[model samples]
Target: MEKRKFLVVVDPSHERHLALERMLDIVTQRRESIANFHLLVGFEGADKADPNAPSEVIRGKQWFDELMAPVDATGVDYTVEFFWTANWRKSITDAAERFECDTIMLCESSAEHKRGITDSKWDLVRQARCDVVIVDEGTEAPIKTILAAVNTQAKDAGHQALNDRILERGKFLAEYFNADYHVVNAYTDSENFPDRQKISRMSGLPREKIYRDMGKPEDVIAATAERIGADMVIIGISPRTGLSAKFASHTTEKVMEKITVDVVALN
Candidate 1:
């Protein structure tokens, strides 16, 4: 089997450590066969403004070491990488590409809207070619359930492909954490709406775990997550503009604003 590689971005916040620690817990629990975790910390140019400042790379190493001290790194191989750059969004995506990471995980920065209407968190969702798992800083509970918001009425092939990817990844996560996997499809009216049963079978989940409702996708997804206390919601995302962009934004970005759990966005 090909090795699974995860790129974990670490910021200065304790939340960053939390995200990495949670991921380690899941990996340990699942006993993932062959995996490599790459921890990355990017220092803006300002942080390295002093030519004599202790090396950012060295500092990054010390920080990651402390973070991993309590973590049990038994099965997977792990590495720490650091870069000095001002464009963090670009740097993160670049590192993922260079390392060929299967997924990129990071703690959700409260600065989600710092860059006006274009936040780095959402930008990563749009730009990253791989799966992006944004861990809410406030989430500390062991994951017990995962909700996958599927757009069954999606007209485009891209969206359909993404939906499949979402379910696939969701199932893997559920198995890893021994969590319940639920599928939700929010539709408008009933005509030509997605069949919850079909999605249930496709996801290989028990029929009773499937849910279909008529309403806005974001509201329905948020409600379901709250009802079930979903530890994570796996959804699809893409870089888009105009009307398509609005749909993409509503599905994942808007939902993120309403929920407190982690989100795994498959691109």
Candidate 2:
């Protein structure tokens, strides 16, 4: 069997360390399925002030070494990499592509009071080609429940594909933790939306566990997660404009900012 490869962004100053630890725990729990772990760090590009690029690479090496010393002791197949680029979103996507990573894991930074979902985090979610897990402050306790938020009234095929991705990822997590898995669909009009059975078939969710509620998508998903005591919620993310564009508050951003539990935003 092929081992799963995880591309994890390790930032020492931010709360991203929690995401690194969470990924390590998941690898330890499912060693047979996870094959390799690759750690990546992006640094400032060399400028007139700091013309030496190798210096940054060496510094990044030192940083990653100290961060992953414990994991090395555990004898996992892992590699460390450094990319000196001003564009973080591009650098991360490039690293994932180079390593053929199965999942790209990122630590979501603390959201600004008025602005939700930092620019860097949101950019990566939009640019990355593979599935991205935007981890919030994670919990030490085992995950007991997971909620897969989907859009049954998707206007196009791309949106439906994202919903499928979210459900598939959610199912994998639920089985991995042996936890309860539930699917939620919040639509504006139930008359035109697919029924519970159709959603189950499309999302691979059990008919009994599928929930069709009425309200705003983000609000309904957040409420369902709270009511079910969900430890994690998986939701699909849509691509936005380029990084240069102004940050627009989208549904995924609202959901991530409002949800209390860990959120996995599938790209």
> How many clashes does each candidate structure show, in the order listed?
0, 0
Could you give me the TM-score of model 2 versus the true structure? 0.81
| Candidate 2 ranges beyond 4 A from true positions | 44-66, 110-115, 189-194, 239-249
User: On residues 1-267, what C-alpha lDDT tens digit does candidate 2 reach at each position?
Assistant: 345789988654342476678777776677677888888865544452565543423444576677788788778888877665667788888889999998898666642333356777787876778778766664444678899988767667777777778877887878777789999988777575657887878767668788878888789888898888888888876534555223423767888888866777777
Query: Candidate 2, clashing residue pairs?
Result: none
TM-score, per-candidate, Cα-based: 0.82, 0.81
Counting only residues 3 or more apart in sequence or on different chains, how many pairs clash (N, Cα, C under 3 Å) in candidate 2?
Answer: 0
Q: Candidates' lDDT values, in order?
A: 0.74, 0.73
Question: Candidate 1's error at 138, in angstroms?
Answer: 5.2
Minimum summed lDDT over a 10-residue window in model 1 is located at 109-118
Candidate 1 lDDT, tens digit per residue, 1-267? 245688888765333455677667656655454477788865545466667544433454566667777554464677778676768778999889988898898776533342122466677787888888887754555778899988877777877887788888888878767788999888978795887677877799887888787887778888998888788888777536799787767666777766677888777
